[model samples]
Target chain A: MLPGGSTSVTTSMYSDGMSTSDRLIESTRELLWERGYVGTSPKAILERAGAGQGSMYHHFKGKPDLALAAIRRTAEELRASAEGALGGPGTPYERIEAYLRRERDVLRGCPIGRLTMDPDVVASDELRAPVDETIDWIRERIAGIVEEGKEQGQFAATLDGEEIAATVLATVQGGYVLARASGSPAAFDTGVRGLLSLLAPHSS
Target chain B: MLPGGSTSVTTSMYSDGMSTSDRLIESTRELLWERGYVGTSPKAILERAGAGQGSMYHHFKGKPDLALAAIRRTAEELRASAEGALGGPGTPYERIEAYLRRERDVLRGCPIGRLTMDPDVVASDELRAPVDETIDWIRERIAGIVEEGKEQGQFAATLDGEEIAATVLATVQGGYVLARASGSPAAFDTGVRGLLSLLAPHSS
Candidate 1:
């Protein structure tokens, strides 16, 4: 589980009261984050979730089917979390800054971004679709904010909204790699600070 | 193999001309890039390199031992490649631009960066050392250049070189993730362009 994740919620989730299906998905999501698809197996999923083989088969067809549900849920959660700051009242740059500064498991990496490195996930169109769509949606949402910034003259008229948005996304996704590779959140913070300074030079 | 990689050189490397140790290292490097540590096995490496099991065992203790050699070689190669452009005849910004615009196998992603996502790679400090050192070296090199740029008044005096260098590295490493996720090099290109524009607004 992620650092600071609610232990109470986790305990409640795995209790007998929770449905087997929900337990299976929650476990899959956690396992998938820690281990890529190739490293994860049905037995491991069942073991982590405390579900029996029969219960797993009853809930989903197989590993791939269960993985899809987990991936989709993760993607949805990412979108919701980003939207919490993105949709809040602020200038475009401020909103972007908020999104970048939001608390993250720096060493753990972005769940959706990590999938790109997973051979199984990249090989399957069905598996890759949600990952692709999630990235596209995030880019588009940031682009929309950038466009608004340009309209308000907060950014130079010549700046390309979509392109800048893409850069912001890249900085973030890349920051996780930097953090994880070095085993330090300092790497992530450095990138974020540098980008913010670039975006709002005189202010900083 | 990468686009434009010397076919004859590759054939020669795989042929009887290449020594068993060389073949083992080369094969390990290729497999590590494609399958990562968890997905790669000694059996698969031997088969790919066309070496016998005895030869692999003779050359290295095990998969982990072989991976260290491959990773060190890769780190050296990455440094040499970056130095080619970074140390070339141009301004600091120009050198950075050249480095960013260098031809890459976009869909394949960064071999070093990819390892950061591998659970086995992250868990083993022995395996992760080269990756960590390589990234640190690259960032330091970039910071040196950014410092030179600031000294030359090419960038704002208030800019932080190390921080900006980290951001540059993140944009690149993250760009690879974005490109792989979307199955398009366009994402990568957009990021590069966006960052370049930010660096030199007048030029763009």
Candidate 2:
């Protein structure tokens, strides 16, 4: 795993009461985040989930099927987490600020964003769908907020909702890359600070 | 290779007269970008370069050594490419604009930025040195330009050089993630356009 990465999340996810199928899914999510689709192996998944060799096949068709489940679950979680801030009680700019300021596992990188870098994930349309949809969803959601901000004058009249939204999304996705490259979250924070300043209802 | 990636670069680098060591390094660079460090293997490198198996062993100490040389070359090239725009005749804002607008193989992503996602590359200090140094070097170089902009009143007085510099780098890095996710370069363009607007220097 990368520094400050998924070991505890993987370990704590398991409960004796958790169903075998749930274990399998959770384990896949963790493994996919840490190692990616190409680096993740069937043996590794089974070992991490603490499932019997045959348990995976017993629950799902195979690796790709199980991966789809994990990815969907991850996408849903990302959307929910993002909505918590984007949909919260605040002005458009403030709500957008809330989303940007929300905490993340910076050094370990974004779970869904990491899929974009995975050769196997990007190669399979089935796999890439959830990742692509979720990013679009987030961008669109943020664009909606920006649109609100533009109407209310928090943002400049010249700002394009889609463009500003894309910039907001890129700052985050790229912030993780910078943080991981240096093994520090400081760079990520600095980027966010700069972005917030730009979006600070000040004219440019 | 990716849909629009390194085959031509690799093919064009090799000629009958080129030394075995140079072929190995160039091939390593291409493979590393396409498959990353873990996915890249010695056999694959040789096949890509059309060099003998013995040629690798005869040239560098091992895969790690060759990777180091390849990464350093890549870093050097990235810095040189960046400086071409950054050091050109323009105001700080325009020079920074020149750097961001420079043509890139958008889908393939930034080669140096891609390495930060590699498990083997980030895990090894030796392999990661050049990648880390290059990103920092770029951030600092950009920061210097931002400082100049602040001094010349091209950017707002409140803007910090380091923070805005990190934002600039993050947008490019994150833009790649977004582009690769959608399998389109449009998101990257949108993000850059938004940034330029924010940096337009008119006021707040």
Candidate 3:
């Protein structure tokens, strides 16, 4: 029934298929991880997505818009992954240990960590807000668990929940940077082990 | 008189001009902090250093050569600074605190931290070794202090020296990343304060 088309409206809708917006976002994520913000180009994004110039322009204003969407999506994935581990039932120590020991592609490096290194990415609030929110959310979530542990008499009475939480997060992130710089996972393991040992006496 | 030159060889020897190699290395360090390895260009280095094309090429073969020199210089500087702080006289705990509370331009981020974010820099051993050495040196230095504290009966007998040292380095490096990401110095202060509190009981 569509004008100048032989197919029915439903068929035409099915034929139009893949959403250009989704394709653009997926392409942006991959490129951003591989090349970072300053290295990625609009042309590269369009080509990788297999979407024409007009289709991309129609879906997103430009590269920055597409990048913001990509960064937000990355942030969501990071939050979901952290919540999955932190929100589970366990002692605060157990939950934190699980989060640290969770299987990770250590050599590939953290996507958020990669973004932080990009000067252009960090300079823009639109790009950085999601990254900041993700880390902040993580620190707060961990701190909450530590607070509950303190109340339950699991951690030392003198323990500072917020500071310990900050220390925990900093260790993991700093571990990644150390591991990558050393070209081995030894430093990362050493750091994590060191943190775990510090928490061992506090575990229930 | 030397060969066909009018000036004596002694005249050339008396000149205090910085060698082309030294100028190139210094310029690369500044650019690396601002633009990272992937973003900085040879032309930019030469222009910034006020050295000509022939001068740069005559001293260093290419960008990689120049980068190696800069990395080594940065590593040496990091070692010297740590020694200056960690080598001072005090109770081990006091010395550690001095190192932690030492003035820093937190927002500038650690020069080595900037390198870890650069994908290309991490991929090259010639560039990454110095970064690793700098961090390892810090951890060992601090670990020795913690050990000395334990020996002096300053810290609890149960303390883990190496672990605490790892935590110290990790917190500072991680704090910089968090602060830069959030565009606030509060995160840095929070991490530092938290770390200091952890060591509070050890102070005597």
Candidate 4:
């Protein structure tokens, strides 16, 4: 058997088998979500990660570098989550409905929407590119499905796929703003339901 | 007629006929658009408004008070602008279309959306209340028009006026976020067009 003290130390040092970089990234993501770019301090990140200062500095040159990693990770997770809703074997209307109905903490706002409001996040191309790309991907993905539905006669012949896709995305993001502003989830639900009703007649 | 130097100095101060408070609010509104709440300093507001420290302090107690005044001014301006679009004598569909088509510098983002993203703004009731009221007023104003449309047989029999009103407001706000994120006005146009198309059938 391994030495008890060494094994315990090993477990403490590398719990969950997350590498040093992953731990740093995870911590940065949480901090970014909580305090935003301007409010989060490096000391806070290190404290949350349970990592030493050297390890963090070694992994990332500075806050900007750490933020880039976090933004990319968030983008990827958003895309994957969306794909899970949009890629199933169903009519385009079904897919759209499923995506809209996906559970969300409306009060917290969309992670991507939060970034749009951030001056620091919007000022840097390094931070904004992932956000732009992720949203573009989502809109394109939805538009493609809508286009497919149009070709298959699942939607009205006059439906504008690209425009509808933009509307769908806008409704959800805008819904979050309304919910946050009113301090209630009802506004968000109302917006989503309105969008769904708009799509209902087109569903086969 | 008055003493030359003293008259000149007093005239210079009142030349524009704008009050110091007005100047301060205008300056804070622009700064809030650019720097958000945390990034904007009291000094920045004073300098931008060309008001001296003594004048600023004499007019307002402190930053929060100044910000509250600025926020209220912004709310009033926003309501006035929206009323220009929503209060006109037209079909509900026409009024909404006019509101949506109201020329906007879409990439700059909405003033209220910018405030919602600000942690400091969200934390203070004095700051948040005007934002809440302004958005609520816009939605209610639009909903009132929609209800009128229903009475006039301009909307489909089954349409939900409140839901559609929320959707319309959310779309515009979300469109701003999307456009700002992508650095393009295309998303905003697409969202507006899609909503207009949705409303078209009801117009007849």
- Model 1 over residues A97-200: C-alpha lDDT tens digits? 99999999889999999989888898889999999999999999999998898888787777898899889999999999899889889999999898888887
How many clashes (backbone atoms < 3 Å, residues ≥3 apart in a chain or on different chains) does model 1 have? Answer: 0
lDDT of 4 by residue, B1-204 (tens): 112112223324334878888888877887787667876788777777778877778988888898888888888988999999888767788999999999887877888766776767776777889988999999999888878877888776567878888999889989988897887899999988987777776323
lDDT of 4 at B165: 89
State residue B32's C-alpha deviation in candidate 1, in Å.
Answer: 1.1
Off by over 4 Å in 4: A1-20, A51-55, A202-204, B1-19, B52-57, B202-204
DockQ, every prediction: 0.76, 0.79, 0.37, 0.50
TM-score of model 3, chain A? 0.85
lDDT of 3 by residue, A136-180 (tens): 989899889878877878766677777888877777777777777
Q: Give candidate 3's error at residue A13 in angstroms.
A: 25
Tell me the spans in candidate 1 whose CA falls farther than 4 Å from its real position.
A1-13, A201-204, B1-13, B201-204
Question: 2 or 4, which is superior by DockQ?
Answer: 2
What TM-score does structure 1 among the candidates reach? 0.93
What lDDT would each prediction earn against the true structure?
0.86, 0.87, 0.76, 0.80
Q: How close is each model in CA RMSD to the real structure?
A: 4.0, 3.0, 9.6, 7.7
Give the C-alpha lDDT of model 3: 0.76
Report the candidate with higher TM-score, 2 versus 4: 2
Candidate 1: which pairs clash?
none
lDDT of candidate 1 over B1-204, digit per residue (tens): 432222333434477878889988998898888778887878777777777768877888888899999999999999999888889989989999998989899888898999998888888899999999999999999999999998888887777988898899999999998898998999999998988888772431
lDDT of 2 by residue, B118-172 (tens): 7777788888888889999999999999989988888988998898989999999
How big is the positional error of residue A39 in model 2, measured in Å on the Cα after superposition? 1.1
